[model samples]
Target: MERPLKGSAPNADDEQLLRGRVYGRDHDDPDPGPLPHQTYAALVGGPLDGLLLDITGWRTEEVDDGVALITELGRWPGGRALYDPRSGEPRTPGPGVSCRFYYSGDTP
Candidate 1:
């Protein structure tokens, strides 16, 4: 489902789902780690130049153009979904999106 606008207050259900995704629970995956790599897909509009999406650490900020998602560039996991272009996962990165891996600077 499409996410609510940046400044929009999520409904109870939406908020609950967001919380579950962020914090994880018996149903969802745990916090993917401090510096987990991820793919950033633009749900609406086009991509911005020089923008990096670090899956592990990211935040949605409102800019004059709307919402801006910022992330860092890092190493990609080996054959993992984090950076795989085609992992066959239901939520694999989509079109007009970019992917990057991250490192938390902690020993695994």
Candidate 2:
């Protein structure tokens, strides 16, 4: 999904795309649309860059602390992708991307 420009409201097309798409829904379940007040952690850089992480039930501290995500880059089976919360302006790589993480080698 394309990140909307910072400070820019989502256009009609954006809303249309989000329609009928439910986050974390099982493949077998019918589409029930997104949950209310849904929020996400936009990953920047690394193998999972440009991906939106579901932070629906996460606390403020958890979002601030960032997370170690599982990835398939570098490692044949799997590895951990470390990410950190971004601070200050000019740090966000793009719109909706509040966290920035770099490729610092994969961790098993």
Candidate 3:
């Protein structure tokens, strides 16, 4: 039987089947089940340019505040690469992209 599309509402039977069990590729099975959709933020103009940040389950305020990424470019080894939201309001660079972040600077 064909599997339901990702993100489609799960019916009672589907819910029951999924309850209390992790679904994915098992040691014996090579075929992994359908993967869920994910949200991401695109990083631009920095050491981490072109990297996608997984923003699944993140709050709006948290995304706007931006994030500090660990990179070798920091003051010391494994330092931080800071990034800020490109805009005060959220803007999607493309499909499946929740927002875009611009390089701010690096920190120790």
Q: Which candidate number has the best TM-score?
A: 3
TM for every model, in the order presented, reads 0.20, 0.50, 0.58
Q: Each model's C-alpha lDDT? A: 0.28, 0.51, 0.58
Q: Candidates 1 and 2: which is better by lDDT?
A: 2
Per-residue accuracy of model 3 over 1-94 as CA lDDT, tens digit each: 2334432333445444433222222324443223247566666755556556767677777987899977543344466778888666556543
Candidate 2 yields a Cα-based lDDT of: 0.51
Is 1 or 2 the stronger prediction by TM-score?
2
Q: RMSD to native for every prediction?
A: 17.1, 10.8, 15.6
Q: Candidate 2: which pairs clash?
A: none
- Tell me how many residue pairs clash in candidate 1: 1
List the candidate 1 regions with Cα displacement exceeding 4 Å: 1-8, 22-67, 70-108
Off by over 4 Å in 2: 1-37, 74-76, 89-105
Q: Which candidate comes out best when scored by lDDT?
A: 3
| Candidate order, TM-score descending | 3, 2, 1
